[model samples]
Target: MGNKRICVPNKKEAPLFSWPWEDLNNYKYLLYGPLVSKVLYSIYKEEINNVDTWCLHILTLFVLRAFVHQLWIIYSNMLFLNRTRRINQQGVEFNQIDAEWHWDNFLILQAIVASLIYLSFPSLANLPIWDFRGILCCLVLHIGISEPLYYWIHRLLHCATLFQQYHWLHHSSKVTSSFTAGHATFLEHLLLCIVVGIPILGTAFIGYGSISLMYSYLLVFDFLRCLGHSNFEVIPYKLFEDVPLLKHVIYTPTYHSLHHADMATNFCLFMPLYDKLWKTINTRSWDLQNEISSRTKSRVPDFVFLAHGVDIISSLHAPFVLRSFSSIPFSIKPFLFPLWPFTFMTILVMWAQSKTFLYSFYNLRGRLHQTWAVPRLGFQYFLPFAAEGINNHIEDAILTADKLGVKVISLAALNKNEALNGGGTLFVNKHPNLKVRVVHGNTLTAAVILHEIPQNVDEVFLTGATSKLGRAIALYLAQRNVKVLMLTPSTERFIKIQKEAPLDYQHNLVQVTKYQAAKHCKTWIIGKWTTPREQYYAPSGTHFHQFVVPPIIPFRRDCTYGKLAAMKLPDDVEGLGSCEYTMGRGVVHACHAGGVVHFLEGWKHHEVGAINVDQIDVVWKAALKHGLNPL
Candidate 1:
């Protein structure tokens, strides 16, 4: 939520649900309870005949719930849409969306589901609407009977073979949309219906259930599912807190979201009790739910976005060979190192690795003074022969973050190039056990780099001009009417970039294919440098900014770069003292800063593909405020 200072209990001791009355601040949300009751009462009126009413009511049940679901969404959005995203998951909340597909699917299934279970005669109107015993019995019978069946059946579907063939579709939207609730395979959909059908239909034949109770249960059931998928949590949690046991008996929207987010956990549908008993509950679900339930109109959002730096293999050769060689009992082998055999071996390793980069990640815990972690994904180097390995490294890096429970992650450089799904559809499709969200942090990086440019710089020289980030920056400068000197190894690529530049800024280009064209420029951007070291050079006197991780800082040893500055902990980070990092700050790469900015801004869904000019302005403003835009 955009709110600041919302109190969240320490996760270690936090309960699954908070006490509602204790939340006096959000007690206003409880006001909607009566509104909910009033609307539901009107929808579930006394029926004329039990038989026709059962059929009519069964169909009416879905529509009534759909109406309530939509109304709840609109009502919640009116007050808390921007303040909170979804029912319980953190970061930016979604706007009211068309969940017609969810509605349509249910409608499509309504007739089939009704006929299959003989939903023709509901219990008569003899049972009072306020008959508390009848309602409690209905609620419990459903929970007791349906959830255990749903749990085991659900768990069975997760068996490796079945999951890939059947369940992946339902798990597709880790971040649920309304349709997400209805997005499972038709078989899965039928099973969902059967779970509830047993309770509603069983009451009709048993002679004690009422149309009111059936619809009420059905209505509440739909509302909860929609609530689980809507991505917003408006229930005053303290109500459950006051009734302590209600927490275990009820499931919140966040609880269900955890199921979709990370499969293989939270198997029970109605409540987590079965999940708890079966030990199938996700470890992080409760604490995360409490974190969301604890939100108020005051409190900064606490979402962590992870990122990583990747380098072309050639760049790491100098470091990898230097380190590996040094690590070898160098003191004992000092004489050997200078000899022909050792020297020849070192050069050979560097040569072979010149094409591929190493595979590893470094944790950046305290550098940003916020909860941001980046695992710079790298590979052994380029083997024009084995590019697939690099792709695997990126995949491995993503799985690493997801398994660790990161909520959102940003892909940089080649990682962005390889995994820039319009909505992360690819990763969602490929990684079934996936949980973490992905963002191409290109937007904020665009913002920071643009901010780093000194006002005196007019003409810009950009290298690797055809790369994803490079292309974005080039277009942005063109949009701003700034002249650019484009240099890349490919003439075709440079020309393509020139054509892509807006017509108004076409004359602003000093387009050149030769590397020498970058000479004498006031501003230079080493845009994801991928060229061999011997072929790349920076203009010594110009203000140069490198955006890649482990930056091309040594393009020229004598050229000055931003001095690495150490961060002062706890004091700079508002008492989060456990964060560990040696103080250092020169220019942290723009990609890392991009991840940090998303964490600070509470933007969980601000997934950028190619950072646009507008995003640059937003991030630039934030970077300046934080003093992270070092030139």
Candidate 2:
């Protein structure tokens, strides 16, 4: 038989009726319901029918109950509100915002409302205002009316100008942790309280309840309000949510937190009715996990402004050009093709030719001006002559350095084989004062060289254009308190990269344009060489080089064969026979042989079983060596 599911009774169920209690309930209702009904019943029963005195007594009772209820309700709500504030304080440190503004405005508004209510209803004061019925009536009016009114006024305060001047102080706490709820100006608080309280009290007075009863009802409402605002969500009574009426009337702590986060929604105080009616209720579940994930996933670039600039240019320029082209007539556009294509080709050809011709022109100009020489006052000039391969310019550099009496350091040509074949070393061999250094190997080693330069060396010269490597050298030299000067084909890329990747050289690194470098005494010729990938795969030098290979079958075979063969076998020969000894041998041999063969063959396909076994053995050996035993 299927297991039976246990059923439990709901806690809210109560007995239908009890004789004496029912009678008492009826008696209380009769006493509080109405004075006219009581008087009529007395007269019909012939019980002391003094109509004038009876009427006066009934009027007094009605006035007293109304007054008492109002007072009780107000007191109760205030206590509950204070309690919520206190609990919120325990959870976090409070920081008040716009203290003077909040207190002054809110408190003044409250005082004005309270004074008005007191002056308008003086007859309520003459009656037995301290009575239970009067207090209960007052309490009910305070909560029922005040809550909806507060929501409306509070929403109004969120209007642009009003919020900036007053309401913004209340919502300053964006995180809205527990303590943030009550951290508002006194004026703000007072205004809010009075706005809510006065309307509810007025409505209750109109409903014919004694003031005392309103006060009592208010006390209950205030207690629930405090519970709703408290960060603690411990509901002691499980049946509270089960009852339709009670559940609908009460607000939960989570409901209040949502109000703080999204101020425009969740305006109702005691219940969600006003919010629902006004279409301002926020019923969406808060997912903190998703919020955190989104924050972590967002990527903020290091140079955000530059990236933004690039985006703006790309967006604006393309649209502008497209619109300009679209406005032109189609027949006119076909006629303009000859001129447009010729102009485009001319520009492209000029750009390509300028790269080489520009460098040569500057080099020749420097030689004629006797500017390719370095001064003795600790200035090192790095001329990128060899990279551009203008031999006549390099000769000019040597002659200028010799005349200036400055030590010339050369960054040997990168294409050493070609340079040697071309007899470029003849000039270097002739200049006995010149020193040549060859930079080889990885980037880190280059960094190390820049780190260890002799202090006596006044300046360091780079033989090529300032690129990533050039920037690194500049930063390194700057750190060592050395000045760097570079000679390049042009200053365009150098200026751009320098701005993008700012080096904290602190005035140690300086860039001389090809024009300036040419005007100086000494110049170094640096040759430019393109990498294989840049030349063939990505002519524009844009794509990155990454090598990825598949997993090897040999590694997998090694794991499977190594693990299974190491397992403990049965001791009895007869048991081995029963276990199919020949089959077991064949399987083991196959795995071991397969692994060795694959290892020899250099197979690059993944083999899960062998990989698992090899991993198991490796881990086992490592653990054993480390004196770690699973048992």
Candidate 3:
């Protein structure tokens, strides 16, 4: 015990302390998040008075938290107010009804047995609170002391190399119970105590908080820790949903639940403030919470369509397929494949050049990624060939999709063309038992293309206007009193498509053109246009749909265009897969969006060959309402 409050941060460096500065709520205690670091770095900082005494203080807090935490675990189990599904590494979980209340009995004993190490330390107790202010100080100081250290260490624990070795023990409980809070290796527990206790000890040695406050902190921290790890969310996030800034201040059970479920984001100790700053916070934290815990079942995803590079530009998509073919085959060389070889990659090697066709490509490759959130998840698979260059591996991609419980599959790019008459018959005829519906994903693609045109713009310059997708987008906009500047390689073909769709373009203020712009329409939809790279140019804020693959000519460096699509989508979207990066691109074309669209409408055994004009708005509005927005 020593002197007065010794350390305070300078105004300039401490932005975290400032309220409403960057939409953060103002709390009375400005000093939080990294306050312990400020204190340790302050002028009043002191060396330990006695190493043994500091050691004894740490030991006492651990013992206190352990015993109290154990009692709360038992008490909480008795009440069982918030039991939830237990998640695991491989995406498998049991029903809540299937669970027995007493399954956690060994877990409590496990925690108690793990705490026996504290017996070796010298007896220490009776930490007392000196004053009324000390209680507040204790609460605030605990958060400040532990947050920074724990935040950094927690991030370290998530490092891929370290997670399996050290952190997986705690993550074993996907749906965390109170006992699971401290369920870590001794090293992890000791480190956790150090990080949490550092701030407490930092202020305590200065006599800022009393011994009673110190004990209170130990107990309070244990309670909150248990609460954070508690599977069910007790705090109504809706309580502060109206207050934008207040919503950002505190942590919720769902916040931590996401960490267990996804295992990639939400890596802060208390609040997600540090996570927000670091840009690692899951964009779908709340939606994921509801999706995972909600009683509703059919709303959950039945299937998801994931693919590698899609489309006919073998020049572009072939590289991804070729790489897959060059690697040791998944079916053939299961013994040689390294590191989770059997889990996600479902490969098939079909040697070509046997009188059927002429091509050097020997293998049709498919990758089905499994990032499980619940019983059914979306599959992330790879396209076999770049559009028309090699045989489309629709069957290979479909087989992997079937294995992942994918009920409906979107044949991205040329895969759609491979199906007879652009209908998914080739796949439907083969895989009858899987009941996998094959989708061109073109109508939804057309729907998304039409949606991408900005309201500020009077006219859209649609490229490849005569093509299947381009014609649909042009008519949808033209009919809605929007001026359409249709760009086509052939004027006659463009007019034929307009006449074919039976929607008169000229009467609807639609102007068919041959690659020249008028009216300075800044917003452009680059649909099905795959000329050389230089042909694709637009203003800085241009939003291009570019639904056809070999995607938008890889946009010139000097010219900037924002590729718009639905992002951080709500889980309710059928076949919605991981938002976490699975491939080279994050924002996908309308093809992927189409699978999600078809899944939601419950169109089993339905095939959308060429997108009709009438269905465009229905799909676009659905995508827009749920998750399709500018992100």
Question: Order of candidates by TM-score, top first?
Answer: 3, 1, 2
Best-fitting candidate, measured by lDDT?
Answer: 1
Which model is ahead, 1 or 3, in terms of lDDT? 1
Q: By lDDT, rank the candidates, best first.
A: 1, 3, 2
**Candidate 2, 218-254: lDDT as tens digits:** 4454345444544433333344535645544655555
Q: Candidate 3: deviation at residue 345, Å?
A: 15
Residue 410 in model 2: lDDT: 25
- Alpha-carbon runs more than 4 Å astray in model 1: 1-55, 75-103, 116-136, 235-242, 296-631
TM-score of each: 0.38, 0.28, 0.41
Indicate the residue-level lDDT of 582 in model 1. 15
Clashes of each: 36, 76, 11
Q: Report the alpha-carbon TM-score of model 1 versus the true structure.
A: 0.38
lDDT of 1 by residue, 351-438 (tens): 4543322221222333322233222234422344444554555566567656656556665444555333433335656875665656
lDDT tens string, model 3, 1-631? 0111112244222212211221222231232223334334442555433333333444455556666655554433321122232222121122110121222222232233323322432222223446566656655765665675687888898897566566655665444656567555445655765765565555555556565666676677678777777655556545555665644566667788778777778887776777787887888876655444553222122544534322122211111222221121112233333423422232211123111111111100121222111110112122333332222344555665576466676654544553222456555655567666667777776765565566666767676666677777777777777777777657667666667544454554354554446325566667554454424445544545565444555445544454533333343222111122222112344666666557666676555455678877777677666564434
Top candidate (TM-score): 3
Q: List per-prediction Cα lDDT, in the order shown.
A: 0.53, 0.35, 0.49
